[model samples]
Target: MSLSQSFIIGQYVHRNSIIHRLDPRAKLVIAFLFMLSVMLLNSWLSYVLSAVFVVCVVTISQIPPSYIVRGLKPVWLIVIVTSVFHIFLTQGGQLWLEAGVFSIYEEGVIKAGNIAIRIILLLVMASLLTLTTKLGDLAQAIEDLLKPAKRLGVPTQEFALMISWTIRFIPILLNETDNVMKAQRARGVRFNSGNIVRRLQSFIPIVVPILLLAFQKAESASLAVEARGYSPGMNRTQLRTLAFKKLDYQVLIISIFCFALLLALRK
Candidate 1:
């Protein structure tokens, strides 16, 4: 996958829609529930209903469907490989194709289709969350959610900070990779139209520089944090505070209701 496509995975896009305006905590809660409901899905009917709900939410969020689809382009190969595995490796329920010891069953095809849809839904929903919420707000929300674990000596703030840094660095690394690849390409390195081994070899120049850059960036980040007098366990204040509002409550209730309906359908 190109770095441009990889860059979209965790990068946040600013917008002024309902999903963008909701408290990050509320959005996180609903996304968590929605993911659980999607994983629980089994039948075609359940998947159809879930897809409908996802579309409705995406429509309301006001993000272009094309953008969401583009974000998923990088993962299409993995999704296809997973679906193929399910289709061929699964055994039982009246064989559709048989060759020697290998057999493709009727059940396998359906199972593969279901698994592919489930994965796509999961990615789309996650992308929606990242696209609508700011990284700082997401970090704060994660910290708020993990606050209870601090009683057990967990480093909630540090974990939240790590999460925030991770999201922040994704696009940085991707852009760096793109730059490295373009430099290599300029020197007549063929990334495409090569055998698997040759293609892997072509990436060596790109990978080494990326690792060095990553370490350098990490050191710089550490120094910046220390210079700011950041202590591991110290209380930190945010410029913006998160609070739940009427819209958040309404969205939560509706999300929970839909999740319940999905569960009931699955049962």
Candidate 2:
């Protein structure tokens, strides 16, 4: 599959579901806590529980299971390389294998699995958040959450805008890269075969063009921002003010309850 086909980060799914109806602020907070919980999780049982919980949440979000799974396609490369490093470089417990300079230990294997699962969980939750919420709402939600920091002279609006821009453009950049890849492939350039260095060298054709496109996009965004009289640390109006409703509070309470339940279960 093309990178754009399997990689759906920053894409919003317009669905009328329980999760979609909730305020983005609540969604943001819940996503943050969910990822944090994943990171803190240590045991296999905890991960199994978390994975089940994520599946339930995905169902509730009304996003197709295939979409959720496809989102992990681009992540496999990073996860594989990272897991390899963790398993080979890290050492503890019983030695699983000794191969010259690289030795795999039982603890390293366990740790690598743990970290890979953690990374996947984090990405899944993040993707779910972006999928269920619009970029505008996400940005406004972030600004609302960071409002208190404004008292300390923080440019909360700008910070939120920056994050919004980053998330909003990731998929675009990936699509652009995919287009470049297809173009190169049409010219008989191979990216998936041969030695590591060969594959890296094959990708060099797209780097400069992608960088140029990124710079052009940035310049255009800056020009548009200036045209709109954008200012940092200034009082701004929101299209839709984020206010927690009864349903939002109820979901929050349930999430907290489940978190407590998981904590107790882990203990």
Candidate 3:
């Protein structure tokens, strides 16, 4: 698939909307808390409420729902695998099916359903953050959040910078892979018209070029860093400052209150 056809996971789309305007730190905190609350939930009603919250946020973000759905397609396999494991391995409730030595229980099915929903919710929430916030903003917010760790000699800034670059390069690597595959195809390399071994071999031609390109990019990045005289633990100035506004606090309060109410209802 071409890069355009590939999923956009960590790329930001500029839009003037409540979600897009919120502070990145607030978005990060809210999404993390929401996912954690979803994990603690034990009822379908709670999951429904979580889903509604996610849909509402997406609507506020002004990002196309189609984009979100397309982005989720890449992760559907993971969600399905997680669901299948839960469905077959978990045991409890009424027996729904029995064939030979295998049996399906009602509780297992319920667990599977819950797991699937949770995975989708987490993906949607995470995608919302990256779709709305810029990578630089996210990195700064993370560094600020982890600033206290600096006192403990934890290299929080480096950690945050590494994470930001990793996220920023996800789309780049996918695009590079697509380009490499196309180039290989132009050279009469058939990636799909072969047996298992042949197909595996086809990837070798594609993988080598991408790896070389990746190393070149990494080396260039390192040189750029040194050219800028970047020093670990040195005081640096930010081009943009992050500050929490009244709207940020209001949204935080409302989200926390709603999530707490849902958790209470689950009891």
Q: In model 3, what is the error at residue 125, expressed in angstroms?
A: 0.9
Q: lDDT per residue, candidate 1, 75-123, as tens digits?
A: 8988999989999898779878898977899888988898899889999
Return the TM-score for candidate 1, rounded to 2 decimals: 0.95
| The 10-residue segment with the lowest total lDDT in model 2 | 258-267
Top model by lDDT, which number? 2
Candidate 1: list runs displaced more than 4 Å. none
Q: Write the per-residue lDDT of candidate 2 for residues 1-267, one digit (tens) a residue.
A: 777778888999999999999999999998888877776777888888888889999999999999989999888999999999999988899998998988999999998999999999999999999999999999999999988998999988899899999998898888889999989999999998999999999999899999998998899999999899987657888877778999999999888777666566654
Better of 2 and 3 by TM-score: 2
Candidate 2 error regions (>4 Å): 99-102, 265-267
Residue 35 lDDT in candidate 3: 87
TM-scores for every predicted model: 0.95, 0.94, 0.90
Model 3 misplacement above 4 A: 1-5, 187-205
Q: How many backbone clashes can be found in candidate 3?
A: 0
